[model samples]
Target: MRILFGLAVLCAVVVTGISYFVLYRYVSDVPENKICGNIYIGNVNVSGRTKKEAKKLMEQHLKEDAALEITMKVGDKSAGATLEELGLAYKDIGKVVDKAVEYGKKGRLFTRYRQIKGLEKEKLVLNEGFVLDAEKTKAVIEERVEVLAEHAKDAGITKSADGFDITKEKKGETVDEKASAEMIRKYLNSGWDHKGFKVKMAVKTEEPSVKASDLESIKDELGSFSTDAGGGERWKNLKAGVDRINGSILMPGEELSVHDTTAPYDAEHGYVEAGSYENGQVVDSYGGGICQVSTTLYNAVLYAELEVLERYPHSMLVAYVDPSRDAAIAGDYLDLRFKNSYDTPIFIAAEIDSANQMRFTIYGKDTRADGRTVEYESETLTTEDYGVTYKENKEAELGSMQYAGSPHTGKTARLWKVVYENGAEVSRDVINNSTYEKSDQIVEVGTMSDNAEAAELVRKAIASQDKAAIEAAVAQAKGMSAAGSDNAGEEN
Candidate 1:
């Protein structure tokens, strides 16, 4: 019996010692209930138990209390419990096995609890496509607040004053670059307070003007003139004329037509009726003698020796201007045009006066040698003749009287060649072949007296220039001659 009791005591002692060792281990491994001086439930003070036993106790305690449940009852619905709430859920009996297991899998239980506490304390920050940790979320919120403060400092949202002012309720000044950047930063960080965001911009205005030197150079060239005799009133007239030809700038290889520069024939513009030539007849019309200006300009162009593009003459011969000298225009129908032959600009000057005189002059850079000269020569090529026709006046008796008839109908082809050189022919060009028309003939029928009387009367009428007596005597003589010719033909 003594041996048995001793063995049993020894076994009991051994069992107690093993239990104490296990409890000590459990107590040593248990997390503290306070997280940085804040009370929590997951960390509990348990002693003399294994890890499995502590876990079973923790789970049993957590299941009993409504607040300690893994799922919390909110109204009639069950919602997921927060980490902080879960940490405080377990009873304060020994160590919390659930927390230990959870923490072991997810780092320190105390650290998780503290993080959840911090999340509950910090302001929420919502970012696009981002789920931030508690610390990061707090930092984001603080940064956004700072950005918004900076934007308020940089921004001026005051209303405009009256009129053009920018401080009244009617209008407001726009936000600037700094303010706009700050607002955008705030928007990206906090996803709240969006009243100050803006896209700012600036614009500048500019004015244009012509250079003084360019204007002066143009004026000098236009004012300068060559005043020789042929240069005569022509140059003066040209100077006066171009005074009105403003805004005309001719570029090299460009063509200019007189018709483009001249004002249209409108009575409102003070254009008067003047004599103009057309189809062999002279008539009065508005803007009539402007061709003189064209012709004069043509001459000046020749003097300047520019390139002639197109030129046409009056249909009939003109007395004021030579047959070949005149240039005619019928509004857009006809125009005298030329091209700037030089590699520079040329200004046209024209003048017309009450005397029906016109002159045209061109101003350009001088490009001629001292000894260089140009001359023109003309030659007749062919003459075209129209067959003659006779006209009789029924009111007068037949008569053998000849009167100075109207102008003849014929055509003359003239070759005008221009030679350019000092004395030798450097280049020769055929200008044109001109054609002219001839006039027609007409006869009057008159009565005749007796043959002897008619013969004497015809002779006297021819010598004395007596038209009436000649007609009477010719009528008498023609009757006798016709009767005699018929008799002679019968005898034959």
Candidate 2:
């Protein structure tokens, strides 16, 4: 039994040795620069081919990919990107090709036998012919997607010579970056079979918040106000008030308060003492000129046909606007308020010009028919002489006295808004019924010596109503009299 086993082992060894020799010779028989049988560089058969011949064969297939262009589409919109741009490219296959050519040849007899046998059953596949550069892919994908992206546009309003017009809203669309790249990847993995392809793109939609039709009716200047602007803390206060109200916007039925527009009424908020109504007297206080801004805006709101929500008439008549038309605001206690009743959004534009004029313009849709206009007028309902209050002094010219500025008359006034439809007064509506208390006519009486002669000269001059005679008497009185002096020019 041992001898039979030995003979069988020897027969097997000799047969195996012959097989190894045959495999080795087969491997060596391949041309120096040619690949072994059944070798593939990404489906491009290179077996039994020289290095130059294999590269040429591969180049023909690679040329197809080099010129490859893929269009990414979202709905009907499409944009194209190149394979080279997406970093899906093939290059430097010489080393891999050379390795495949020397596969079974560069090994021991047993190894060579196994390699040749294995190759006979399955072909050698090399993925080195294709490489992916991630950065390049990202850039290419974004560029292509951007070409198909549409940005949404918001609604807008424009003013022209004729009137105001609105711009309609526009929708936007875009592609999904990740999904677009994935689609390209699947196509690339197909051995770049199709030179050019169109991929189904993922799309998104964008909407606008404001619409043009929402502003279609805002076409008129409702109400407006203007006042004198002068340089000082008072002027600064008025300008600061205007700055606060500048570019203010309001929706339909919304109200704007004077106090809310001008807050923190102090030097810290840019206010300076100017003339203002306080306790029935014109006094200097912080935020003094700020009321003029409110007054101007109030008038603009009225002309624009907006509703007057809350307003207060000045205790003393304001000189900037017509009497009874002035809007007075005192801190938080008193405010000038108005509502945007035009059924659309309104804008406030306030400005203090170089010509000492502060103007407030109200812009909104004008629903007034053609050839229509509005006007506000102040009518003096009743008038009465201001009372006189004499203050005694110790001067010798007892009767001689001077009052500060001019005496203001006390009166009750009514404000009326007259609407005209096509050059005719259609109707008149009362806006304000204001009453003002008379400011006392102050007289400084000289009490130093009670000079009867100077008093007689003054009375004679007043009787004549002659300017030269009164001036001559006053010059003689100042030169001769002694007690109290009249300082008329020293008053504000």
Candidate 3:
């Protein structure tokens, strides 16, 4: 019995010593001392190394990751962004080390012992966490993307000294920001698996709306009209409206909305307050005298025999057009619209030059006969006129008045769409019967004092029907009286 007991005690002491030593390894191999087996920091097995040794390995890998350059392949071209430029830095080094040491050391005594042994077979991978200057990276990517992007070209035409220069449409290409950002982030986190990695960038393309070939069918002058663009803001408004409609190519069966093209008029958009007909009187407003452009376009469209979708006449007569021939546009309320009813396309070529003349030339296929022609004849049906209007001016003499403008005669007129073949009228159709309101004569009467010289000048102007002479005389009289009154009021 004594011999058997001694063998059992000896076996227990040996077993105890083996357990204590195994447990000693588990307790001592901590992040403060050394990294245990089966631990990895982003695929770099940091097994069985001291704390100092593991840091050296991780720092070297981090530096490698930071030194890598990422190539962004865009189509046939490519650009690159380096980790140093992106401000890439590993931030969770300490945390990763702590976790690596803590692994397999938790749970009860038996569980801890089991895990320490198990770690030899079960590998633990802790990817290196990092932070980056996202804004800087984004800016770098955007700049490179912009350099690689191609802008689209919109269709346009400029009148050259020869015929006309046409611009063809071009497709636009750009980088998809979201996709590129994601791919770049993933590549950067790959632990610099590649020294200089090449990644395909995401790009998008867009097509232009119009093309030069769309207007190829426009080879002939279908119809045309022109009007005198009087000077000042009124002329500017007219020119602006015409320019907006110019170079516009209409596809077959498409309608052009004048309001949609030119609207939201303001001084900010190169428009000024000019004389415009509103209600029954003339007023100053933005895009004034724009009706002249629409009126001119209407006549051209009529001669071209294009389909008129919508049109409205002004309340009063416009000197540029006859009573029944005028077309008016008032914000979004009133609009003048037309359609390209033919199978071919049409181009509206409008211009205003140094001669102060505005012209709109419609270009399209003229299917009419060689001798066939169209004409617009405005016939006066009835005529009426109101007398005159007198307005007092504090600066002008009582008997002497300056003629602001002539009174417009109210009339009922019919616009006939007449077709002439072989120089003879073959058909006549009434297009519109417009009734215009009369505009009263306005004169600024002098309120300062009566002047016989100015009065005689007015009489002579009335007799000879000279408006320029009346205005000149009235201005001279007002100047003379103003000087005289100032002299009289001064101390003598």
Candidate 1, residue 361: how far the Cα is off, in Å: 1.6
Report the lDDT tens digits of candidate 1 across residue range 359-405.
45455565676556665454545444433333333334446444424
For each candidate, the alpha-carbon lDDT, in order, equals: 0.46, 0.74, 0.77
> What clash count does candidate 1 reach?
33
Residue-by-residue lDDT tens digits, candidate 3, 43-84:
688887766677788888877877888777877788888877
Alpha carbon deviation, residue 433, candidate 3 (Å): 2.0
RMSD of 3: 12.9
**Residue-wise C-alpha lDDT for candidate 2, range 1-492, written one tens digit per residue:** 999999999999999998777876876665666688898887677888887887788778776676677776766677677776777655577787777778777767677767877989999877545655678866875776656667677676655677665678898865666666666665666665545888786666777655676666666676677777867667788888999988666778788898987887888988877777766566788888777888888888888888888888777766778788778888787788888776778877788877878888888767778888999999999887876555544553544566643356778999999989988999999988998777766555443444566666665664565556666766666554543344423557
The positional error of residue 335 in candidate 2, measured at the CA in angstroms, is 1.6
Best first by TM-score, ranked: 3, 2, 1
Candidate 3, superposed: residue stretches over 4 Å from native: 1-154, 173-205, 388-406, 442-492
Worst 10 residues of 3 by lDDT: 456-465
If ranked by lDDT, best first, what sequence of candidates would result?
3, 2, 1
Model 2 CA deviation exceeding 4 Å by range: 1-219, 392-406, 444-492
Query: Which candidate leads in TM-score?
Result: 3
TM-score of 2: 0.48
